[model samples]
Target: MLAALVPLPVILPLLGAGIALMLPGRRRLQTAVTVITLVVVLIISLALLFGVDALGTQVVAVGGWDLPYGIALVADRLSALMLVVSSIVTLLVLINAVGQEMADTANETPVSVFNPTYLILCAGVANAFLAGDLFNLYVGFEMLLGASYVLLTLGSTAERIRAGVTYVVISLVSSLIFLMAIGFILAATGTVNIAQLSSRLAELPPDIQLILHVALLIGFGIKAAVFPLSFWLPDSYPTAPAPVTAVFAGLLTKVGIYAIIRTETVIFSESDLRIPLLVVAGLTLLVGILGAIAQTEIKRLLSFTLVSHIGYMLFGVAMGTVEGLTAAIFYTAHHIVVQTALFLAIGLVEQRAGVTSMRRLGGIAVLAPGLSLLFFIPALNLAGIPPFSGFIGKVALFQSGFETGDWLIYVLIGAGALTSLLTLYVIGKAWNLAFWRDPDDVEEPTAELVEEFEERREALAAGKAWKAKPSVPRTMSLSAGAMVGVSVFVTVFAGPLWDVSSRAGENLRSPQTYVNEVIGHGDGS
Candidate 1:
C-alpha cells in the first residue's frame, strides 16, 4: 500500500500541470487544480514520512520490473522529509503568486504560464528526491530546469531576459557535466542504479572512483551555488517575479545539496574527500557572506546569504559523521523555510513600495508594522538568532564539529561562527535602511533611478496595465505570513524534527540498509 503512494508526489503534479495547461483561459480553475494537487502531494508526503519511519524504506520499481534494469522510486526518511517541506513551500508560493495577480491588474506575470510551469517544477523536485538511480536523477534535474527556464523569463523584460540567458547557459554547462558523470559511472561500473553502485563502485580502481566522485561534486556544486561557482546565482535569481524568486531561493539549491548528501553517504561512502570539502565549505561561508555585505538590493542581499548558508549544510557533509549528517539535514530544512519566507517578505516590500533597493526605501516599520513583523521574524531566523530553528540547527552543527575534535573542523567552526555574525549584521543593516529609518530622511532617488522607475510606470500605462494602485494584496500578505508561521513551526517542533533527522542520518550512514531494501539481502551487484 505504501509503495503504491511513492510515485504520486511526482505523478499528481504532472497530471495537474497538464490539466492547468488545458484550461489556460480559466485562471480560477487552473489555480484550483494546482492547489488541490499540491495539497494532496503534501498529504502524501506526510504519510510517506511517517510510513517510512514506521515501516522502514519504501521502494517502487516502475512497471513492476526489478531493479538494475527498471526505474525505482524510493522514499526513506530523508527524501520524505524533503518532499513534505518542498510541498509546503511550493504551495504557499503559488498562493502568493495567485494573490499578486488578483490584486494587481498591472502585474506582468502571466497566470497561464506560471501555474503549469510551476507545477512541472514541483514534479521535478519530487522526482529528484525520490529518484533511485543516477540517470533518473539527471532526468529529474532536466524536468525542473526546463520548467524554471520558462518561469524565469516570464516578464520578457530586457533585464529578466538577460538574467535568464545567463542562468540557462550556466545551468546547461552544469547539466552537461552531470550527464558526462553519469556516462562515466555507467561505463565504469556497468550500472547507474544507485543501489547497485553502492557495492560495484568500491571494486573499481581508487583513482577512477575519485575522478567520478569529483565530477559529480562539481556538477552538483554549481547547482547548489557553492562559492567560486556561485557567481551566476546572485545575478540570475533576483530578476524573477517575487513568488518565483521566493520558491527558487527556497528549494532549488537545496535539491542540489540533497543530491550531494546522497552522493557522499550512499554512493561513495568510503571515499576520503573530507579535507577538501572542509576547505571549500570555509571559502563558501566567508565569500558568500562577504558578498551579502556588499549588496544594496534586498533580493540580491538575500541571494548572497542563501549561498552563504549552503556552506553550513556542506559543513555537515564534510564532517562525514552521523551527527554531522543529522545537523546538515536539519539545517537544510531550516534554511529552506527561512530563506523562502525572507524572499516572500521582500516580495511584499517590493509590492508595497515599488522598489527593493535599500537606498530608496525607509519607514516600513512605522507605516507597515504587520509587514515589518513578517520580515523581522524570518530575518532573525535566517540570521540564526536564538530560539529559532536556524539557531538550533547551527548549534547542532557546531556541537557536532566539536565532537569530531579535528583541528580543521575546529577552523570550520570558527568560519561558521563568523558567517553567523556577519549574517546578523547584514540582515540588521537591511532592516535599518529599509524599515527603521524614516522615509523623509532617505536620500532622494538618483536621476537614473528616477528614469528607470518612470520608464517602468510608463510602460505599464502604455500597455493598459496600470490599473491597480501600489499596495500589498491581502492574499499576498497572508501567504507571506503563513510562510513565516511555518518557519516558526519548525522552531516549535525542533525536537521531534531533530529526532526524525537523526533517524534519517542513521539510515544514510548505513547505506547497506538502503541497498538491502531496494535490491534484497545480497550484495547490491
Candidate 2:
C-alpha cells in the first residue's frame, strides 16, 4: 500500500490530463477532473509526508522490477513536503486559470487547450519531485518544458511569441546539455539510478569526477537561473499569462534547485565545488536585487527579485551542512508560496489598473484596498519582515552561516542582509508609486514605452491585437487571496514546518538513508 502511494502523485495527474484531453469541449467536466485530481494529489502528498516521517522512505519499483533495474519512485520527507506545497500551488493556479478562461475570449471556443496542458505541467512537476533516477528526472523536465512553451505562448501575442522563442531556445540548449551529462554519468558509473550512482560515483577518479560535476552544474545552473546563467529568466517570465507566470516563477527554477540539491547531497557529496557555488550565490543575490531596484515596471522588478532570491537557496546549498540544507528546504517551500502569491496579487493589480508599469499606475489604494492588502502582505513577507515565513527561513540560514564562522560566509551573510533591505526598498517604491501617489501625480511613460503602447492600441483598434482589455473577475480576486492565505498559513505554522524541514535536512545529509530505502539494505535484508 505504501509502495502504491509513491507513484500516484505523478500518475494521477497524467491520467487526468488524458481524460481532460478526451473531453475537450466539456469545460465543466475538465474543471471537475482537474480539481478532483489535484485534491487527491494533495491528500496523497500529505499522506506521503506523514508516511515518510513515520516509516522512513517509501520506494516503489514500477512493474515489479528490482533495484536500479526499474523506474523507481521514492517519497522521503523532502520530496513529499515539496509535493504537498507544489500541489497546493498548482491547484490554486488552476483555479485562477479557470477564472481567467471564463473572463477571457481565449477560451471562448467549444474546445479549450488550457486544461490538458496545465494538467501535463503538474504531472511533470510531480514526476520530477518523485523521480529516483536521472533519466526519469530528465523526462520530467522535458514534459514541463513542452507544456510551458504552450503556456508561454498562449493567446499568441507578438511579445509572448518573441519571449517564448527565446525561452524555448535556451531551454532546449539546457536540456541537451543535461541529456549529455546523463550520458556521461551512465558511461562513467554504468547506471543513472541515483542510489546506484551515489555509491559508484564515489569511486571515480578525481579528474573524471570533476568533469562530470562541472557538466551537471552547468546544465542545472541554467535551469536554476544561477547568476550569469540567469539573464534569460527576467525576459521570458514577465510576458506569460499571470497564473502561468506565477507557477513558473514559483516552481520551475526550484525544480532546478531541487536537482542541484540531489546532485550535491546524493551524487557528488565529496566534490570540491563549494567555493565556486558560494561565489555564485553571493553574486546572484547582490546583482539580482540591484537590477530589481532599477526597474520601473512591477512585473520586471519582481522578475529580477525572483532571480536575486535564488541566491539565498544557493547560499544554503553552499553551506553543505545539515542546518544549512534544512534552511534551504524551508526557504524553498516558503518562497514558493510567497512568490506565487505576489505575482497573483500583481496580476489583480494589472487587471484593475490596465498596466504593470508603476509610472502609469496610481490611486489603487483608494480604489481597491483588498488588492493593495494582498500585494502588501506578500511584499513584506518577501522582504523578510518579522513574524513572516520569509524572515523565519532567512533567520535559519543566517544562523547556519554564523555557526560556520568563515570569513567568506560572513561576506555572503552581509550581502544577504543588504539584498533583503534593497528588496524591501524596491517593493516599497512600487507600492508608493502604484498605490499611494495620487492619480494626477503619476508620470508618463518614456518615449519608447509610449511608442509601444501606441502601436498596441492601434493594433487593438484594427482588431489585430491578441489581448482584449480584461474585466477583473471576482474569482480572480478570490484565487489570489487564497494563495496569500497559504503564505500566511506558513507563517502561522512555522514551528511544525521547520521541524519537518530539519528532519528532511538530517536525512539528506546522509545519502545512505536514501540509498538504503531505495535498494532495501542489501538483498531485502
Candidate 3:
C-alpha cells in the first residue's frame, strides 16, 4: 500500500505536464491543472514523509520486477523529506510565475511554453529525489535539464539566449561526465541499482573504489555549484525570469548535494576522503562569499552567497559523523527555503523598483514597507541571524565540527564563521543601498529610464494620458510573502525538524537498513 504511494509524486507531475501542454491556448485552465497537480503531490509527499517516519523505507519496483532488474522508486526518510520541501518550493514558485504572467499580456510574453515546461521541471525534480537507480537518476536530470533550457530562454532575448547557451553547454558536459561515471560503475559492479551497488562496490579493489568515488563527486560537484566548478551558475541563472531564478537558486543545486550525500554515505562510507572534502569546504566558503562581496548587482550577489552556503552543508557532510550528517540534512532543508524566499523577495524588489543595481536604487523602504519586511527577514536569516532557522542550522554544524577536534576541522569552522559575517555585511550593504538611502542621493543606473518614469508620473498627476509600468502584482507579493511565511514557519518549528534530521542522519550513516528495504536483503557480513 505504501509502495503504491511512492510513485505518485513523480507520476502526477509528469501527467500534469502533458495535460498542461494541451491548454496553452487556455492559460487559466493550464495553471489550474498545474496547481491542482502540485497540490496533490504536496499532500502525497507529506504523507510519504510521515509514512516513512512510521513505517521505515518504502520501495516501488516498477512493473513488478525485483532487485537490480527493476526500475525502483524508493522513499526513505531523507528522500521523503526532500520531496516534501521541493514540492512546496515548486508550488510556491508556480504561484509566483502565475502572478508574474497576470501582470502582463500573454502576447507580450510566452505563457504557452512556460506552463507545461514548468510542470515537467517539477516532475523531473521529484523524480531525481525518488530515483533508486543511477540510470533513472540520469533520466530525471535530463528531464529537468530539458525543461530548464526552455524556462531559461523563455523571453528569447539575446541576453537570455547567451545565458541559456552557457547553461545548456555546461549541463550537457556534466551529463556526459555523469554518464561516463555510470559506465565505469556498471563495469566495476555489474549494476546501476544504488541498493545493489552498496554491496557490489565493496568487492572492488581499493584503488578502483577511490577512482569511482572521485569520479562521482566531480560530476555532482559541478551541478551543486561547489567553488571552482561553479562559474557557470552566476552567469546562467540571473538572466532567467524572477520565478525561475528563485526556484533554481533554492532547489537545483541542492539536488546535486542530495546526490553527493547519497553517494558518500551509501556507496563510499568507508572511503578515506574526509580531509580533502574539508579543504574543499573551506575554500568554497571563503572564495564564494568573497566573490559576493565584490558584486554590485543584487541577483549576482545572492548567487555568490548561494554558492557560499553550500560549504556549510559540505562542512557537515565531510565530518562523516552522525552529528555532522544531522547538521547537513537540517541545513540543506533550511537553506532551501531561506534561499528561495530571498530570491522571491528580490524579485519583488525588481518589480516594485525599476532596478536591482545597488548603485541606482534607493528609497524602497519608504515606498513599500511590506516589501522591505519581506527582503529584510530573509536577508537576516541568510546571514545566520538569531531566532531564525539559519542560525540554528549553522550552530548545529559548528557543534559537529567542534566535536571532531581536528585542526583542519577547526580551521574550517573559523572560515565558516567568517563567511557568515561577510554574508551579513554584503546583504546589509545591498539593503542599505537599495532601500534605506534616498533615491536622489545616488546616480541613476539607467538615466533615460528613470527620466521616462518621472515624466510619466508627472503626466499622470497632471491629468494627461501616460503609460506607466504596472504596480507590483498582488499575486507576486502574495507568493513571495508565502515563502517568507514558510521561512518563519521553519524557525518556529525548528525543534521538530531538527529531530527529523537527527533520525535521517542516523539512517544515512547506517546504509544497511536502506539496502535491506530496497533490495530485500543485505550482503553477508
Expressed as tens digits, the lDDT of each residue in 73-95 for candidate 1 is 88999999999999999999999
Candidates 2 and 3 compared by TM-score, better number: 3
- Per lDDT, the best of the predicted structures is 1
Q: Compared to the true structure, candidate 1 yields what TM-score?
A: 0.94
Runs off by more than 4 Å, candidate 2: 102-104, 107-111, 445-471, 521-525
| Model 2 root-mean-square deviation | 5.9
RMSD list, candidates in order: 5.4, 5.9, 3.3
lDDT of each: 0.91, 0.88, 0.88
For candidate 3, the C-alpha RMSD (Å) to the true structure equals: 3.3
How displaced is residue 296 in candidate 1, in Å?
0.8
How many clashes does the backbone of model 1 have? 0
lDDT of 1 at 451: 49
Tens digits of per-residue lDDT for model 3 on 1-525?
777899998889889888877766787888899899999999999999999999899988886676668888999999999999999999999999889883134532465678778888988998899999999999899999899998888778899999999999999998899999999999988899998788889888999999999988988999999978888999998988899999999999999999999888987777768988899989999999999999999999999999999999988989999999999999999999999999999898888766788988876775677888999998999999998999999999999988888999999989999999999999899989888986667676456336655776688799998654446889999999999999999999999999999999999999988888887822222
